[model samples]
Target: MNSTYANGTVHRYEEIKFVPPSNNHKTEVQSKDVTILPNKNVSARLYLSKISRKNKKFPLFFYIHGGGFCIESTFSSGYDSYLHKLTAQANVLVVSINYRLAPVHPIPAYYDDSWDVMNWDARGKEPWLKQHANFSRVFLAGDSAGANIANNIMVRASEESHFVLSLVGMALLDPYFGNGKPDVLWTYLCPKTNGIDDPRFNLAAHPKILSKLKCSKIFVFTAGKDNLRDRTWTYYETMKKIGWKGELGIKETEGEGHVFHM
Candidate 1:
């Protein structure tokens, strides 16, 4: 790994421009940004499918983006296109966070930003969530490093007695995890952690913490060809081992790689 983690790493490869929220997907979906954490310049875009808008209520799908916790934004061109597809198909009102990333910001900084957004909206501070979101149907979801944040937030929410918006489920998509090679990335992103053995990077390493996850319906999707497949599977198995009483599901698609859903 490079001794100079910030300027010389993958985290510095930022998008040149943030694509504005658009209803131009030519689909029956409307989207706009809502501020969650003003001090951090953190916010999320809300996408409402025609059905959801008409019905005036829908499942709350709060998404954390995957960018190795470094270079990507939910408003990036690729993610914007992908978000359109997700909103159109899921028929759910989706809120994707623009959480702070790593290298420039570092580990728990990324996690803190995400947790703040979730905790804020859940308290009814965000109008979109308060008016139309079904708190009972709330699901925390993400891909790759975003998925990592999703898991962490759920556990933290469970521990906070004041966090009343219950998370019903979580969809972890092609999560970037491991005990070896990816440790370099985690150390670079987190800096404060003790490498691969860190609970954040290796969920299986901490059964007690894994047991803290409160969602009842857990869904994990992994690409068969994804290098992180074994690590993702380990997380699922460990959740079961911890005696987590939930409906657990896993879908592995052969010949696919990381974040293929995008």
Candidate 2:
């Protein structure tokens, strides 16, 4: 599908149509793209992959891709690589979600779509999840804007106890709002009215919701030069202050920008 840029230019954003290149560590795994109807006829593509194993039930890693909440797909090269690595190293089922974009759908639309997919998967209501996912050991992960969605999903799930997502680990890569001080470059690059501080995107507005997250291990990766460094740090601090019994891993890489997580 194509999208219209802020400059009123319509750009073609191609759907993920190619098989990812195979890696040395992983066997050519089973992969398929399926559509899930979250609300009425509104649907999003869910990319599911499995690494063959003998007896042990592997952990589940659900990943969300980053594109400033408006671009990219689950099959982007960087995300595809990351999933391959996670599967090779952890030997877990990796599922990447393609949420609805903004501008056309706007804030909360992405959140809603994410929540619907997550809830469906967590409840084993989705056929793919029932067949492939091992619910006992689960992890939530995301990068850039996708990191924001991952965090929000955890918060919402914990607050309402909507679905029993027994997530033991979480990995957030350079999480930030589009309007924070560090996000000045992003604002200049793609100016928009509703951003990080907006009530819709503001994580602070739902403190109660976030307080419910009780993960055992939280790993955060951020670059020193990234605009969202401060925000990511603050989030890390907040999670600790809220009594989250988890270990934090902050890697400060030099010369890496926002998309480095990819």
Candidate 3:
């Protein structure tokens, strides 16, 4: 997606390809959109597996969709399909955030909605969540740029005491962390950012930050053939070097490239 920014506004010159969210007919997973901001028509997609026990609550899977802080959405077919299968197989209630995109809203705008969703007392706000979601076992998962958002949320949660949810773990699938250099897409979305070395994009620069993650465990997945592979490795090594108290799991797919599993 190509974009031009000027005077606090951005214009995109390309037509982005997108597929609307839909439930797979063959799967037992059912999904629906829930309103987040009725005035703005902002919403999120919720996925539940029909095979689940009638009265038992399942772990909550709060997911953020990846599109480089620009394109894609929770309503996109790719994400919808993946979350459907994931909800069914993992036996978790999937709450996929559909944050505002860039070329209009920009970086922190996307992050803000995600942070709000993460902090929402869902059990008190939504009936389905109250009945079906086990908030005590909340897990945050995302791929690529979404993973970046997930990590930033974790870091921010580490520094704040007001977060309401208890996160058991976080899963980062081919996170989009960058090396020590300016990134075009990132700099575009975060115009005032201090380049790619900003703590949001470069966790290695802030070694102690990893130790303060609010979660008890973390799982990071990387594709060996991905361009961002080394950056993920750097992040993993930094976590180890900091002697982070949380349990850590790292996995790499030898012949794949960025988010291949998705």
Best by lDDT: 3
For model 2, how does the per-residue alpha-carbon lDDT over 1-262 read when each residue is reduced to its tens digit?
4556778675657555434434343454545555667353343334344434443355778888887776777766666666666666566667778777655665667778878777767777666567767787888888888888888777676667546778787888887543344454344333454554553355554445456676767788889788777777777666666765567667768888886755
Tens-digit lDDT track for model 1 on 44-139? 888877753443777888898897876688888888888888888887778889987656677788788888887777786566666777777889
Per-model RMSD to reference: 2.7, 4.5, 2.2
lDDT of 3 by residue, 1-262 (tens): 7555566656655454556556666777778778877654567888876744676788888899887777777876678777888988898888998888886776787778888776663534776687878878888889999999999888887788866677889999999997786677778778798888988898899887777897999999998898889988999999998898889889999999888986
Runs with alpha carbons beyond 4 Å of true place in candidate 1: 1-11, 14-17, 51-55, 180-182
The superposed Cα distance between candidate 1 and the true structure at residue 76, in angstroms, equals: 0.9
CA lDDT of every candidate: 0.80, 0.66, 0.81
TM-score of 2: 0.77
Clash totals for all candidate models = 0, 0, 0
TM-score per candidate, in order?
A: 0.90, 0.77, 0.91
TM-score of 3: 0.91
User: Which regions of candidate 3 are displaced past 4 Å?
Assistant: 5-26, 121-123
Regarding TM-score, does 1 or 2 come out ahead?
A: 1
lDDT of 2: 0.66
